[model samples]
Target: MPKLDLGLPSYDSLFSTEEERQESKLEKIVSIPIDKISDFKNHPFHVTMDEDMLKLIDSIKENGILIPALVRPKDDGTYEMISGHRRKFAMSHIGLKEMTVIVRELDDDQATILMVDSNIQRENIYPSERGYAYKMRLEAMKHQGKTIDDFENDIPVEYNKTTSAQVGRKPETADVLGNQLGVSRNQIRRFIRLTYLIEPLQEMVDGRHESEIKIAFNPAVELSFLTTDEQYDLADAIVANDRTPSLAQCQEFKRLSHDGELTTEFIQETLEKEKPNQKEKLSFKMSEIDQYFPKDFTPNRKKDLIIHLLENWARKKSREQER
Candidate 1:
């Protein structure tokens, strides 16, 4: 029997070649059946799949997979999907037997990092998604005995790690991934802030109404600064009003416990005060031009009358002088 030429390379050997290093860089590519794939249950991207995802699946059915997914092999002869979850769903929708994959022997942390880097670039992912991904990656890094502090030193300096250097003070691995993903470090910070929100708001973020939640670190921090009940109260108001509380509301939320200053009355008053004002539309009909004046007079008519009288007086004066 002719040997099946899989063209597979050892994970270490894949990175060793001068030519392959320059050309393909990633180790080996293969076609793996979707049935053999397991999920990272703890993944930030593992939110419930929605009907909107079927649209993405439809696109994939028409175009095939534009970008290959990354996967790591398990000892049980199965593959764990690292990224390209949308593609995976789409593939399953179309009944694809196998998907093109870049197979690597990645530890859990490496797999999560690779998955985040893969998807962070594709679209406007919700702030909650990025936040959850960053938070999960931080925990994963911690499990690996890797603090955000030690990440810079872990990678070989010669590996020319693309995003290792740009994280500002108090850098986390998520920050490094943010740089690699071409998003602002502050954006990474904001998403992680969402981690502190209670489950109800987190669920909102996981769904389509994420904008309904004010997700900045200040609001989150101020909200976090509140007691659990207080955060719940404020969050409830946020939901009921279909609007976020103002900075004053945020400040009141922070200072409520100070000698009973923020009361139910205060909250009601603040809501009333902060409720957006209804705007009235004004229109002037062209047919109503004479409403404020005589039959058809305006200030311009008075000016024209003055000009005519002056011209007549000047002509009469000129005629008298000539006579």
Candidate 2:
């Protein structure tokens, strides 16, 4: 064999060895321009500019995004952000043009599962957020050929079998998700049901106390079975009357819906019925009552004083009537 002269540069300089290339792929972190990243499709989580977000922005500004975002490269030369939406938003708010991201090769189902799992670890997830997240993850899991029973224990097999029969199907992927999330399977199903709610009603569930009408989770779950049009009708009834459905009223709505008799008029009539909580609750401005109570008085002390005053007034009225 004669020695041959090759004009190519050294292999190490020209291209990485297979092992080195594999190592580089595993070490996927890279700096990508913020504008080059698009949000995950149908991202169920809400990215709000609330107190937590503000704190995150402060931390990132001081610490320079200590954790890198997880993203997937797209065919369009952009990256799809699978997680760290809040971090991205914070970076953008602080005028950062580029962000550190870890790019992973993931299919849609894998990305969805990862997105849900990553965000579900947050402490402030809303009911609606959990609802949509669970639904997405459940679908993804099923698409990946995982079954609900695969995650369930043997103890619940008989019980699940009975319930599954009633529902005319196997225990859904929500059951598997529930096992992972430490929620009861029934509760997981309820949360997934909330995903069917109209946006207004869903927002009511998300913004419960802050919204004009407070919707309890149980009642909201019951209302979720109503058709889209019926849900809109219920929402209108709620806003118009400034009242949310009681559990019993929600049951009535569900019954009507199941019978295919639910209508806007029925929703109004059902909502118009007085609920126990609908009793006129008297509220006084804090400024109006603050003058009568000692400056140092606690709310309990103020309440005691108000009760004593009411008792005295009742006694005086009784005495006047006796005379």
Instruction: Choose the strongest candidate by lDDT.
Output: 2
lDDT per residue as tens, model 1, 89-197: 7777678879998887787777776776676564656666777777676666677776553321113223226855543356566566567667665555556767666
Clash count in backbone of candidate 1: 1
Q: Number of backbone collisions per candidate, in order?
A: 1, 0
User: lDDT per model, in order?
Assistant: 0.65, 0.84
lDDT of 2 by residue, 1-323 (tens): 98687877677765667667677456388999999999999998888799999999999878898889999988888999998999999999999999999999899999999999999989999898998888788888888998743322112233346445334346566666777889877677778788888989988987743555668899998888788899988888888888888999899888889889888898898888788988789888878889878799999999998899999999999999999
Mark the regions of model 2 whose C-alpha exceeds 4 Å error after superposition.
Answer: 1-25, 148-172, 208-211, 283-323
Stretch of 10 with least lDDT, candidate 2: 149-158
What candidate 1 gets wrong by more than 4 Å, as runs, is 1-28, 46-55, 141-146, 149-187, 203-207, 210-221, 257-269, 276-323
